[model samples]
Structures are given as C-alpha cells and as structure tokens.
Target chain A: MNPPEISAEILIVDDEEQIRRLLRGTLTAAGYRVREAGDGQSGLDEVAAKPPAAVILDLGLPDAPGLEVLQRLREWSEVPVMILSVRAQEQDKIALLDAGANDYLTKPFGGGELLARLRVLLRRPPGPVETGVVQFGTVTVDMSRRVVTKDGRDVLLTAREYALLRLLVAHRNRVITHRQILRELWGPKSEEQTHYVRVYMSRLREKLEDQPHQPRFLVTETGSGYRLDVG
Target chain B: MENTERLRHPGWGYLTALVAVSAATGIGYLIRPWSDYWAVAVIYLFAIVLLGLRLRQGPILFAATLCALTWDFLFFPPLYTFVVTRVEDWMMLGLFFVIALVTGRLTGRIRAQEQAERARAQRATALYELTRVLASAQSADEVLRNAAGQGAALFGARLAVLTAESEQPGRLVLHPSAALALTLVEQQTAWEFFSGRARSSRFAPPAAAGGRAYFTLAVAGRVLGVMVVQPAPGAGLSPAQQELLDAFSTQIALALEHERLRAEHEAARVQAASDRLHRTLLDSVSHELKTPLAVIAAATESLGATVAPADRPLVQEIHVAAERLRGVVVNLLDTTRLESGGLHAQLDWCDVSDLVNAALKIVGDAQLGRTIHLRLPAGLPLVRCDFDLIQQAVANLVHNACRHTPAGVEITVAAGTDEAAGRLWLAVADDGSGLREEQRARLFERFFRGDPGRAGGLGLGLSIARGFAEAHGGTLVAENQPGGGARFVLSLPLQHHEQVPAE
Candidate 1:
C-alpha cells in the first residue's frame, strides 16, 4: 500500500531565534511544512496572507499582545492555535483559552511531545459522526453499548473508568485538553482537578494497551491536553 | 424699712435703768441735803458703763461727763443741781468725759477690724473649693459639667458651659446644670460667647439672651468656648460672687488646656505604634526574599558552567532548586504587595484543578525529599480570584509543609467545596512534627519561626500565605492534625455566578 501524503502547514511565531529555529527544524524533520514570524503583528499578517493548517503561538510577543493575536485570528478562523508561554499561571492559561486559543503549553516542552500534539491537532475530523465499534489494536470500543472488548472478549470497567474512556473516544483524533476531559467526565468545575483524569486515564491505558508504556490509543499532550489516537 | 424698724426700739432695757439711777441720785441729794461724794462717783460710773454698752464711744463720753457734773453740783457743797460752785468739782467732771470718749472710740475701732478679717477668710475658702473640683474632672465633657454645677452652687447662680465642636462653623455644645435647663436663648448667647462675641441680658430674657453675666473661655488667644452664669431671681450676684466666678473661669480654662494636651499625647502614641508595625512588616518581607533570591541566582549561575553529561542530573537539581527559590521569592513579593496596599487582583473565573496544578508544580518542585499527595475531588465549583496570588499562597503552604516535615514524610494537598457556606477550602497537611500550642498561636505572624535551628529563613512564609488569602476575601488557618501532623487550610469564596464548565 502507498504511504499517505502529508499536506498540512504550521506557522511558528516567537521572538527567540533559537526557539524558532529549534521548532522549525523539529517540525520540518517530522514531515510538516513550517513558516516563521518574529512578532505578533507579523504573525497575524502572515496568517491573513496565507492561512496555515495550524499555528504555534508564543504569548510573549515583541510588537502586539499574543492574546490579541489569538483573538483576531479566532474572529474569522477555526484553525487550531496552541499557546506557548513562560507564564505557567492558571489565570493566564484560562485567559488564553477564553480568548480562543485551542490549547496551552508551558515552556521547556520536548520535541517528541510537540510533534505528537501537532499530529493529533492536524488529524481532527470535520464534525461529529456516528461510528459503531471503534477499534484500535485488539481493543474494541462499542460506543452505543458503552462497552469495551480486548482480544475479542468483554472487559470490565468501573463506572468512572467507563465515563473517562467514553470522553476520550468522543474527542478522538483531536487534542482533548485535560480540563476538557475532567469537565466531561465529572462536571464544569472539576476542570482544575487534573489528578482525577490522570488516575482514570492510567487505568484505561492499563486495560486496553498491549504495553501501556507505548500507548496506541491514549496519549498525553504534556502541559496541554490528552489526545486519543483513533487513526 | 426693715433696718429702720429694728432700730426703732431701744437696744437695751439697761439704758432705762441708768436713767432711773440718775434720777434717784438727785432725789437722794434733795432728801439728805448732802449725798456722799462716793455715792455720786458710783452713779457716774454706772452711767458710763451703760452708755458704752448701748451706744458707740461719742455717746458714752457725753453721758459720762454729764454724770460727773451732776455729782459736783448736787453732792459737792452746791445746794442746787446745775450750779458748779467748787473749782475742784469742775476739773473732775472735765477729766471724766475725756476718759470715757477715748475708751469708747478704741473699742469701736477694734470691733470693726475683726469683722472685716472674718469676711476675707470666708471668700478664700470658697475659692479653694472651686479649684479642687475643677482639677479632678476626667473628660472635657465631664470637666464642663462639673464646672457648671460647681459654679452654680458656689455663687448661687445658674451656670452653663459651652464647648466648641472641631468641625466647620465651630458650633458649641451647651451643657447646662440640672439646677436650670438653659433656655434656647441662653444657649444662643452661650454660642455667642463661643464665637468670642459679647452679649448681655437682665435675667437673660429670651430676646436679649446674653444675660447680665457671660464670658468666653479662652486659652492663649484661642477661644475654647464659653461659660454663662445668671444670678438668682430677684437678686443679682454680689460683687464678691461675680469676682469669684471670674477667677474660677480662668481655672477652668487652664484645666481644659491640660486635657487637650493629654488627648494629643494619646493620639501621638497610637500613631507611633501604627508606624512601627508598618516598618516591621516591610523589613521582615524584604529579609525573607533575600535568601530565596540568592539560591536562585547561585543555581542559575552554576547551570551555565561546563559539567559532565553524566552529571546532568545535577543540572536538573540546580534547575529544581532555582524553581523552588523562585517560588519562595514569589510568595514574599505577594505578601509585601498585599500588606503595602499594592494588591489589586485581576479577578477571573478559574478551574480549581488548574489552580491546584499550578501550585503543585511550584511546591512539588520545592519538596527536596518529602512526597506530596494531591487529593482533589471532581465537580468543585470555580472560584473567582487572582490566580497568581492564590497559587502563591498555596505554594507557600506547601513549602512550609515540606520544610517542616521529615525526609520521606507525606505531604498532602486536598481541596473541597463547602456548599452550605459557599466557600472552597484547600489544605496542605504534613505528617511530621506538628506545632506546639504556643507556636500555633503566632504561626501566621510575620517573621515568626517555629523551629529556629532548622533552617535559615526569614519566617515570612505563613504570614505571606495568610495575607494573600485574606486579600482575596478568604481566611488561612494552621492547626495540628488529629493524626499527629500540621495542616494549613485556605478558605476562599466560590464564584457562584461566574461558574463555567471546563472545556
């Protein structure tokens, strides 16, 4: 069978030349076409001139506010935008998210983790669709019945574990923020409690993956969110 | 008329007795042709004593001379009453009148001088009592009340004290004695006195409110207020009574001045204490930030050095140390900002989980050996707060737990919502040596050290934590856990209206 062709483009916006260079090199080597902007206004202009499939935005911009840029882009575009910032404050993250950034990542992120998040963001399907019996490896998720089977046999899951698994399955092939998972499984106010999500996600991975260390379905986005590999 | 009626009657029945003795002597002379000269002398002495007792010196002398002449004419070889035939008899009568007049004048002068001295003594005693009463008063109100009451009693006049209000237009408070509630007019006159305006009245008729007597109370050219005293009905105060009132007013002024001084002193003492507390807070916070900053600087400098790849964990250690140091500095800055009136929160709706994780990152990095356990329940409400400040406060609590607990001890971060109270509580608990009862009392006090020998810290961690919590309309408390550890809890109001589901 022929390998799938890669076609999505990503824009890297940061003031630091080294960070921009590192991101460009990493993304390019991972089979992605990348463009760069030194400041916020230029990044906005670049997006306006030639819209990319995704954007990697730094919150500390030299010319304009990063949030403003995010807001401006959100006014007309639905392309996924990830905020990069040294400010790891919860309020800052909430503000960026509220301002229309899709996800947030703090500094000192690893290259592999960045690529994994980009891959998931780029692979999001157009809209919600009804699909029965979602399969990954030997584990099959029967969405309608709220059941899971591994090695063609039924698997037992607690009420909480089932809820968590269903949430990840619903947002499959896209980056589901930690806050989003918590809220969906629990409630809106439980978004700050990432620990709950972490515990249940561990349980789900242990049950379904052949080796949980190298998860095929549930993957951490590290500092941003989690993504379920449905492709 | 009363004085005249009292003088109308003869002051003594003894004067009549003397006149009878004179008449009897004349009769005896006539009956016995020659009365003894000794008998005549006794008659003259009796007349002199009678005059001296009844009238003053002049009258006594006249009566004494008349009796001597009568004796010479009737009993000393003169057959008729009026004829003084013997030269010796004439000389004796003249000496008697002179001696009688001199003794009467001396007696009258002595009696008048003694009465004057007694009046002076009475006035002095009244003045002394007035001074004593004014000195013992406590507040300005008390002083005014006492002054008015005492003045009225002492001088038998109605008294009112008016004191000035500190505010604009400088109004007066009229404190009237119970003896007489001042009329509205009298109060207005007192106000006039307060304004240093002169007014007078005869019995202080309402229209002419300034009564016969009113004076402004002044100290060093500044009028404190006024005092008004009206004499008794049907009679004005005597000159002496008025003079005494004036003297007492001066004493009142002096006493009021003393009270003012005392009040000023008390105000200054309170201001000094406030200033001292502010300065101590500043010094404590600055000192606390220094150590953390030094650690951050040292670790950051070391990371730039050439080290073996195998020793990269050392670099990670340095990075962790620096992050911990940064957390400490952030707490100190937060506390200082809160105390110095620089804490302005950019309040927003936040997920408590996000808040908890941010705090955990800072605090978890700082824990060198202890393991921190976080237990956050699902479905807690969003809290409206300054996220940075709340995170720092939590970080400070965690850092405190880490520092106090033994190596490998468990430190737990727990959060929950109190639905009834509409508040959220985040607690950090440590399984280590808990605080003693005494330490718990002052745990949140700035620069208070629980264990002085444990580490070199400025001891501002808990204080800052509490300050930040309180700044957000919350409370922070530290107590020993029932299971033998210390627990620090921060309680904050949950944002009910702005609750947003996490997405």
Candidate 2:
C-alpha cells in the first residue's frame, strides 16, 4: 500500500540503525518527507536546523537519554512528538506523553499501527466537533439525537449507555483510561468505580455488536484502558 | 608491698631485733632476784627465739649475739659489761641461735614460691578472657575495641587498635567508639604494619620510632592490622606476658579474617543473583526477538504486491507474525517488571466471562483446526482483579493448549466459583496427550518446556501466566484431565461485590 499523501517532514531520532532504516522505508513508502538522526545530539541538531512538522524519537538514545532530548525540545517546540518506546517502558511512556509527547508506538510495531498513530498526530489538534452520525462495524450512532442503530435496525439503549457511547465516539482513536471513563460517566466522586464502566460497556457491546464476544469497535487496551477502533 | 617479703631482710628486721633484745634484758635484770642466773638466762634465750621467727638471718644473728652478751655480762658475776664469765651460758646461747636459723629459712622459701604460682594463674586467666571476647565479636571494629580494652588490662598498658579502611584502600581508621584511640600518626604505624611495609615479630613491639610499642594482628601469616601500646615506664612485660600478648593478637586476627570472609561471601551471593537475572534477560530477549524478526525477514523477502499475486498471504503472515512478536515482547516486559517488583494491579469487579471471551479471541488464531467449547456459567459474581493481567494469563493458557493439542481435538474452557474454596477458577482443558508426572511438576517453571524438541516460544508463557495469577492472590495449576488430556486452571480468591441490578 502506498503511504498517505502527507508532505510534512517527520524526523526519527534513534540509536538502532536497523530500526531507523526500517522506519525510513516504511515512512517513505507511505508518502511522507523523512529525516534521520543517529544520536540524541544529532537529532536535536537536525530538529534545530529543519524544524520538522513532527518528530518520532526513541526513548533510549545513545548520546543523551531520549527523555532529556524530549524535555529540551518541549522547552521550545510544541510540534507533535511521537515517541518510539519499547516494552517495559510503560511508566516512561506515560511520563513522556504527559510531558507533551503527542503519542507513542512500541518497538516491532505493525506498519498499519504506525501509520494510524502517525495520522492521529499529523491531524490538527482535536477540537470539539459538532455532533454528527458516526458509523462503526454496521452500528450507526446518531450523536446529535443520541440514538443508535445496528444493521439499519433501531437498537434500544439506556440514558447511561448513550452517554458512554458518545464519550467513546468523541475520543475514538485515542485510548481513554478506565479512571477517566469512570470519572466522566459517573462524575468526579465515582473515579474508583471501574467495574461500573466495564458493566455498562459490556451491555453496550451486546446491544450494538453482531458478535459481542469478538469486539471489533469497542476494544480493551490491556493494562491501559480502552480504544474505539473506528476503521 | 616491699616489706611483704619475709621480714628476714636487714632494714626492718634489725630494728625489730633490737627492740626484742632490749625489752627481754630490762625484764631479766628487774626479775633477777626471783631466780638463779639460769632463770635470767632463760628469759634472754626466749627473746632470741621470738626475733629469729620474724627476721632474716642477719637480724636473727644480731638478736642472738646481743642476747648472749647481755645474759653473760648482766646475769653472771659481772653485770653491765660485755665479758661473759660462764662457759655454760655461752653454750646455751649458741644452741638457741641454731634452732632459730633453721625454722626462719625453711618457712621463707615456701612463701616466695606461693607468690610466684598465684601470679602465673592470673596471667593465664587474662589470656583466656581475651580469647572469649574476640570469639563473640561480630564486626572488625568490635573486635578491635574489645581486644584493646582486654589487652590494656592484661598487660598494664595503654593500648590502641587500628584497622585499614576498605574505602580508603590502605589508610587506617580508628573507630571513634573504641576504648583507647591512637593518634593519626600511630594509625599510620598500624597501616604500615598491616601492609607489611614495617617489620615486627608477632608479639615483639614494632620499630622504636616513638615511645609506643606495636604488635601485628596476624593469622596464618596474613597481617590484618596493628595494636600500639605504651606500658608503664621501665615496667616491661615478662617473657610470659609477651607470649600472652602474641596469643591475643592472633585471636583478634582470626576474628577479623572471619568477618572479612563473611562480607565477601555476602557480596558474592548478591553478584550471583544479578548475574542470573541478566543472563535470563539476554537469553530470552535474543531468542524471542529473533523469532518475529525471522518471520518479518521471510515475509518481506516475498515483497507484498510487488512481485506476485500471492502477496496477500505474505502480508497476512507479516501482520500475524508482528502481532505475535508483540505479544512475546509484552509478556517478557511484564515478567521483568513483575519480577523486579512494581506489578501494581489495576483491579475491577470483573465477570469471568469477560476474561474467558477475551482470552479465547486472542488465542483463536493458534487453534489451527481445533474445536473449542466455552462452559462459563452466566451471572457468576465478579472478581476484583487486574483485567489485563488476567486476560493475558488466560490467553497464555489457551495458547499453551493450542500448541500441545493436535488438530480436530476438543479444547474446553470452563469458569465457575468453587464455593467450598471461596475461589473462582478458569480452567482450559484439551483432549490431547496427558502430562507425565515429571512434566506436571515443573510445568509452571519459567522457560520450561515439556518437549524441548517443539519449536516456537521461550516457554515463558505458562510461567508468566502463573505469575499473574499468583500476583492477584491466586494460583495457576495444570492437571491431567482424569479421563485424558491436560487441564490448566487459574484460581483467584473471590472478591464479594454488591451485584449490579439487571436491566
């Protein structure tokens, strides 16, 4: 498959030569302007010179720790920085993300996942969009009217279910932590009520999904939260 | 104390002798009319015996001579004169002197021998006590302080013990808490002794560079440190005292060596543990990383949609392989995090059906051609657990079964609460080969594969699955299905919840 027609330059900062080459081939094939830096210093220098539209930085760099570079960059630039984190970096990824990194992809990532996350980062920062009908897996949720239909048939849902579905649809591509979902649905005091979210999500899946057992749209991100896969 | 020796010496003895002789003569002269010359003579003789018992030979002789002269001159025909007129009186005086001399000499020798024996016993006891103290010391500093105090008391000297600091690597340190501390210069002397730059015999004092004396603390020819002492001026240790000091030094050296060996052993143990952890990571990462890499390598060589119409299969293989590799990596990372400690679980009151269904979907691709059955009862009370961890564990179990079971065999997944046990369990059973006794015993051990010949996986799945189960106050067990085949069960303690009202 050809890369998306994105003309914006993406800088990859990493120590692993093979990984840099793999990503370069993958990104170039996907129709994006790509730049490479071998170490943290080189990456910083390149960013200063070119000021790329986006940066994909490895958390473990050779010259300086990738986190140090990220912090330095965050001091000046708010350009979307997508980190390439490896396994066991759960804490570091969360910290980096909270510290202004736009997104992250674990090592040995599928080309499909990388492009998908890159697209999310490349898109302009999300703003509150007007309610509209959204279709996913034969289920159409008409948000303006707060109604849901599966396979052209009206599906019954409770008031809470509609609210839950609306929240997930709004942040469809990005993962919403369980605590965040609980707080949103059950109010601030209901942050500890994670099971409430799980029960409601199961009910919603049953009502809207053809195979509730095999979830295609409302997916659980293990050890994190949940993601709504729209595509 | 100087006069404590037999009063047979000249100084005090002569005074005592003069007093006895004069008193006896005055009494004899006053009572001379009450008796013959013999009566007065006997009184003077009695004075000689009293002086002989208390004084040495010189004083006794003076007393006997004075008694004889006084008895002859004063009690015989002539009085107040040195001349003795009677031979019998002279004979009597000589006989008394001989008897006095023999008794005093024999008794004095016995008293001197007893004093020497007592002193020897006291030295032996001091050495014994020092050995006891060193044996009980746990640290090198403790040994030094205790030894210094004991040595000072035993040898009548001010003592100091200095040890070489491990951090400073050859420089000596005097424990501030030690009983008798040495100057920094003195400690330098000790460091030189320990490092063998200064020569000193075991008990012999080191080079007389200063007023203080130094002895090396050595065991088996390995010098540990030194003890510096300043005995009372001119009151040097006897040969026996020197030997005892050497024994004390050796005892202290042995104790220090033991403490050092114990410390080294503890450090070696820590080093070994970290080494094993690193090796495990290296072995697992290299093997696991190469697997997906090999798959990606083969799939990319077939260049999807670029070379042939069969590009679809290669692309599908690539994605599947990539996802599988992702699972392997995630599992490895989770295991490392969990083992290294900080596996905080995010718990939710979850129905077992979610866990079973989620695990089934993830492991579905590995089923090849096997038929699966789900026997999870409806409305089972929710368990408080980390949903992701439990899901991963169940997925691992199903994956494990898929690999072991042959195609077309029935694989069963069942979940229910064991009320008697107050625990909830999710068990996966397969109609494949039943596990051997030995295999079942080590099934959950990390990197343990029942059949080493089988390809794929680092055999960490089952162990990690069990690890997750145990983390949630649960246990994972594999049993041979009684009828036949293998069964793996994950049992977690049930968390009582207020059931949500049904719609």
The candidate that wins on DockQ is 2
User: Which regions of candidate 1 are displaced past 4 Å?
Assistant: A1-10, A21-34, A48-53, A74-79, A88-95, A107-116, A125-127, A133-231, B1-309, B325-329, B336-358, B373-391, B415-424, B436-442, B445-461, B493-503
Task: Please give the RMSD of candidate 1 to the true structure.
Answer: 20.3
What DockQ does each prediction reach against the true complex?
A: 0.03, 0.12
Which pairs of residues collide in candidate 1? Answer: A188-B501, A192-B353, A192-B354, A193-B353, B200-B210, B201-B210, B201-B211
Error of 2 at B301 (Å): 8.2
Cα lDDT for residue B228, candidate 2: 67
Error of 2 at A8 (Å): 3.8
State the local distance difference test value for candidate 2: 0.74
lDDT of 2 by residue, B106-190 (tens): 6467556765676678677887787788778878778777877886676566676666656867576665545555767767666
Across A2-117, the per-residue lDDT of candidate 2 in tens digits comes to: 24556879998977777777778778877888999998888888988979888999876758866789899888888788877554333455466556666776555556667778
